[model samples]
Target: METLSNLECFARAAATGSFSSAAKQLGLTPSAVSRNVAMLERNLAVRLFHRTTRKLTLTEAGERLADSIRSNLEGLQDAIAEASDQQQEPSGVLKVSMASVFGMDYVLPLLPGFLTAYPKIRIDWQLDNRHVDLVAEGYDAAIGRGSELTPGTISRTLARVRIVAVASPAYMKARRPPASPQDLAGLDLIDMRSTRTGRLVQWMLRDEHGNEAVSPVGERIIFDDPGGLCKAAALGLGAAFVATSHALPYLQRGELIQLLPDWSADGGPISIYYANRRYLPPKTRVFVDYVADAFRDQDLAGRF
Candidate 1:
């Protein structure tokens, strides 16, 4: 049991890359977390972390061992936790990840009510655009546009995100509004530059007539964040392609106008994602169900 506890401490530290963070999660002090990791290394006869003043990183052996043990250690912990608590109510810290813009626009609003409903569940939410390894990173769930996820990722569809072309009324007044998908070429288009690929995001649109238009690659204005591009368009910088979910407020307030309303590319479903666990933690289970219920209540599930 002591060895298992030490291994748990070591895995948490490796996942978070900080003794303080791991200690907080483990309900222990930083020194205790550090000592536990040291004890783990001593028992295994292998150095785990290459510790420095500025950062803590796993050594090669540490990386290999962490990879092997993170999921297994979590499973063991979950089984023990399930047996001890019997899961009468959702409790403990729940870690979740989502895209910043989406979470702010949609998920953030649901938090207050959820907290009121499940006071025992403490949420630790992370807004990040990059792909996350849920089990490896100790995240309970992730919400965002559902694409291909890692193996063992189970997803629930929350809503369908539709991509639309938008521009400020003042900006549209300067040029004839895009009568068709191809007319977008005439506008000063603000588009996103993909951080992962370092290239412009491709815009493919289709009209009700089934006529398709592909956005030009070398757009004049390129922004790294999608939200930034939308703001630029709202400021009359130019027309930008954005998720309708995020642009709804600006459109509703008459700050921006939707162009080619009948034409929108399917942006895919906004999904709630979690690992497929043999023993689902009560906190994680309730959070997923709560969000799904909220989406259904709002009629937002699979609807733009």
Candidate 2:
């Protein structure tokens, strides 16, 4: 039991790269967690971590051991919790990741109700654009568009994100509105650079009639974030190709108008993603279900 505790501490520390973070999750002091890791290293006759004043990184041996024990450790913990009566209610720190705009616009609105219902389930939400390594990073789940189907992870799509061309109402009034996708080349277009690829996001426009045309990419105005792209368009900087969800609020406010409404592209699904494990933590399970239910009930998929 003592060895198992030490291993738990080591595993948490390895995942977070910080003794304090591991201790917070484990409900132990940082010193205690550090001591447990040190004890683990001694018992195994291997230095697990390369510790410095500024950072803590796993040694090669530590990385190998962490990978081997991750699933096993989770299974053991789940089994123990299942056999115990204390874990009936979902109560734990639920670490989640998502893009800032999506989380704030969609997921954050659902939080008040979710937190009120599951008062014991604390949230550790990370608003980031990068695709996180779910198991390795110890994240309970992530919400975003086009989440990669990484090994040991499963994604449940919430919406079929439709991409549309949009421009400020003033800009549209000044310029002859694009009569067709081909006319987009003549407009002062705002572009979104993909954060992952560091390249301009190419707009492949498709209509219900099965016709396809590439919307010309522009170098005049560029932004890495959808929010920035939409804002620039709203300011009449140029027309922008953006996800409907990203431009929905501006469109509703009449600040922006949809262009070539009949033509749009599949922007991929907005999904809730988690590790594919045999036994999921109750907190994670409930949060996933709650978000899915909210999307369905509100018809966000159809709206987007």
Candidate 3:
């Protein structure tokens, strides 16, 4: 047990590059973490760290040990957790990342039920519109549009995200409702600026028969956020292309109306991503299943 504790302290310090940072993560004082690492070095009879006031660097032996244990340590911890009280119920902080609007609208609503079911689990939900390196960033899970999968991570499809053209009733009333996507070229168009890239996103619309076409953007009013784009369209600014998840509430309230409903763009699946492990943590496992079930129950896949 002492050896395991020392290994954890050493691994954390190696990964974080500071005793203070490791202490913060492990709920120990800096001196305690430092002592643990020192004890580990003495037990192994190997110099592990090149320490200075400003920085901590691993020695050759330390780097080798860190590399060897990096993957195995989590599995050992999971094994330990599985044998502990966590086996009875899911517990610990489930760190999740999701888009702001979608998280608030969809996943956030499930929190009450989730908490009621697993009272010991704590939520560390971060809402942002960025592609995150799940393992590197220490995120237990992420929910958003599909991206290139990380090597040690896997994605579970929650819903097929569909992008549709929408406009306020007043905006459509003033202009002819687009019979085809080409008609959008003549009207004022709200555009979504790519959050990752500085360029305006071109809308590629597909019909029921699997035919596809690109809609031109006027670039009159551009927003980085889908919610903002929907809001702009609702204010009678122009027709905008946005995901169904972002447009659903507005459409329900009569704030926005779908145009050329037969034509929509494939925005890719909304997936919940997590580490691919031999033994998935109970907290993460339950959270993923809960969210998947919620989406299934609501028929979001069919709707979006």
Candidate 4:
């Protein structure tokens, strides 16, 4: 057994309290993780964990050792990160999780510039609509749009997102544009099922005087995916309310028209969050900085 690998496996298992979970985090098989821990126990002549079919409990010795080594391991990782950051060139794989629309429309396009600046770094990007657990899933960082961030993660605001109401030109020609939030009651709205709070997303609007009001509109079509909803709106199925960033391209291409132009909703901050800020790997830290700089203008409406 590689002593260092065994030590890392043991520490991760002790911290998470499950061999399988630790194995998953470390990208190792459960059997390999178990063997490593067993080898460490044999070398120390003490059982580390009390095992059962349902769970695992650390022994007294194991608990004490874990506590002692955890800080040391963290310090070592910090030292490595610092050293790597100071190197002349950064080289590594950066694993990132981000929302599908934003990732495709913005982040992916900026990759060429980022790659040119740091040629040695490679990105492993995952785009999904759902929130991801960065640390538990071994992702270096995640970009999310919301004011609420997960606990114990370091986050930095990258941009301000704006939500807007939109519909295709044909749809608007058929139905008059909503003059006020109350006018939505008579219009057909496309609903995103994922945004349902208590069966429907409250159709929120801002009046000319800047006061906000909610009007639940009738749904002609419902979809879970933003792409699908955007497509349906482009086909003149119904009026769709979405982020300006997501709808801008269609609006610019004349595929969709912005509705209630005078009204707008301030979405929470768009931020890049990381699990371990203090000891982030060099690649992740660099990528985070690059992304923040790229979106610093916060002019998504102009880009599309």
Candidate 5:
């Protein structure tokens, strides 16, 4: 019988198409990964991969075995997770991924309380704006903005985030505020490049009759970081459209003013997503519950 370690190495190498990448995924040295695959090949009396300096291609037999190994490993993982879920207190590293801004604004603040409540579990939180592959990256859970979730992931609505168009009071004093989404076209738009698609992001707004329209603005300053854009807007550089939560502090201090109250962009739902919901570790379950309860009363618009 092939050892589970050997099978894991072979499966990861085949899946990643590189021994080095597989090694990294498995937390093994590249040479160790190579040796494991070699052992598996010897045991099966077949070549598993055609390796060259730049790439690896799986053999026909290797491809077939890889599929079986992957399925079996996933099943075993699911079974182990199910067993672990039955424990009175979950104790394991819980990995979470989220956008940088949301993690900083909402999730990070709650960590101390969560850690104190559940002392057994450890946390590895990653914050990045780019989309993450939860399964491939080995994340246990993710909190993301927007409605669309990655396929095969379980999603729950954490909150509904509202977006608002805002400009510093100083900027509004120099230029008239945009009365409607359409008026945004003529303004000096401070564009967060990370959020902008192509030339601009469509500002979705609804009128009194519930008619919706998207207005694209001309970009005056394209900033990659949301914080930088917020700062620039606060300094009266240009008008900015940001999630209401992000602009809340500035609004309270009177550094920025909402441009158009009646017209605003709809941010879909702020959601907490996981690869699987059934048999979740107690720590993850408790944390999710805590976040849901914490934000329950506060309207999404007031969360920032």
Candidate 6:
């Protein structure tokens, strides 16, 4: 275990090019990183890093050692993680990221049941719409649109959501209800912009026969959040396209009315993503499976 820790310290230092950066990633201090590297060097009887006032550089031996141990070290860590997960009840902080609206509207409801099932597990949930680094930021899982997933992670589809055009009764009274996708071009538009790209989300409407229809958009008001877009539509600001999961409550409460029922856009897969499939923690494993089962039971799959 000591050897593995030392090797991990060395690998992190090498990858980040500094003890301070490595320390930050490892939740340790720079002195700890330096000490670990030194301890490893002493055990191996080799100088690993060339130290100077300005910068730290790896020696030839250090580079070779890094190249050799990086993969094996990661594999060993994964093995240890898998082994740890195999022991008893899942009991650790399961850090997760999720889109705000979906988390509150759907995932949040499952929490009470999940906690009842696995009392030992603790959840630290972060609500954000942007893509985050799962490894660097130290999140166990994230629930969001599949398109937001970064590389080096695996995702399971919870459901494919149908993006439907909706508006409040007042908004429709102000302007005629859109008869077809073509009429949408003349209506007041409440658009959702991607925070990552600052671009208006494109629409892909399909009719009952599964045919694509072009709806040229005019953005009278724009928001960077799905909830905000829905709220704007509810406030009778304009017609907005939102996921079924997000609009379900509003639709049920009669705060918003669906338009062009046969015409809808594919919201893509909403998935539960994790950094590693090879070593999923028991808490995360159970939560993902439970969520899938819940969705299936409620028949929310593909609709939500």
What range of 10 consecutive residues in model 1 has the weakest lDDT sum? 211-220
TM-score of 2: 0.86
Which is better, 3 or 4, measured by TM-score? 3
Q: Which regions of candidate 6 fall more than 4 Å away from where they truly are?
A: 12-27, 38-67
The stretch of ten residues in a row with the least summed lDDT in candidate 6 is 146-155
Question: What alpha-carbon RMSD in Å does predicted model 5 have with respect to the real structure?
Answer: 2.9
Residues 1-304, candidate 2, lDDT per residue (tens digit)?
Answer: 4478998999889878999988877779999999999998988889999999999999999999999998888888878866763547888899999988888899999999999999999989998788887866668899988867877899898998899999998887878878899899899989988878898998778998999998888799998888998999999998999999989999999999999989999898899999787667789889999999999998877768
Give, for candidate 5, the lowest lDDT window spanning 10 residues.
Answer: 194-203
Clashes of each: 1, 0, 0, 0, 0, 0
Please give, for residues 1-304, the per-residue lDDT of candidate 5 as tens digits: 8888898888878877888878877779999999999999998899989989998999899888887777677677667877867767866788888888778978888889878888898988888776676655657788877635555477888877677788888887867667668787777888866442434555677766787777566666877666776888999887888888788889889999888787676777878877664556677788777777777744443574
- Candidate 2's displacement at residue 280, Å, is 2.1
Poorest 10 consecutive residues by lDDT, candidate 2: 78-87
lDDT tens string, model 6, 228-293? 988989999888888888888889899999999999988788888886556676887888788889
Of the pair 2 and 6, which is ahead by lDDT? 2
Per-residue lDDT over 1-304 for candidate 3, one digit per residue giving the tens place of the 0 to 100 score:
4478899999988877888878866879999999999998998899999999999999999999999987788878878766774436788888899999989988898999999999999989999888886755668899988588977799999988889999999987867677888898988888888776788988678899988899788967888888899999999998899999899989999999999989988899899999887668788889999999988987767767
Whole-model lDDT values for every prediction: 0.83, 0.88, 0.87, 0.78, 0.77, 0.83
What shift in Å separates residue 37 of candidate 3 from its native position after superposition? 4.1
Considering only N, C-alpha and C atoms within 3 Å, which residue pairs clash in candidate 1? 159-302
Cα distance off (Å), candidate 5, residue 272:
2.2
Candidate 1's displacement at residue 150, Å, is 3.9
- lDDT per residue for candidate 1 within 1-304, as digits (tens), equals 4488798888888878999878876789999999999988888889999999989999999999989987787788778877965837888898999988878877898999989988998879998776687755668899977457876688998888788999999988858877787788777889787766787887677777887877644378888777887789899998888888778888989999999898888778888899887768788888899889988988765436
The best candidate by lDDT is 2
Better of 5 and 6 by lDDT: 6
- Candidate 5, residue 157: lDDT: 88
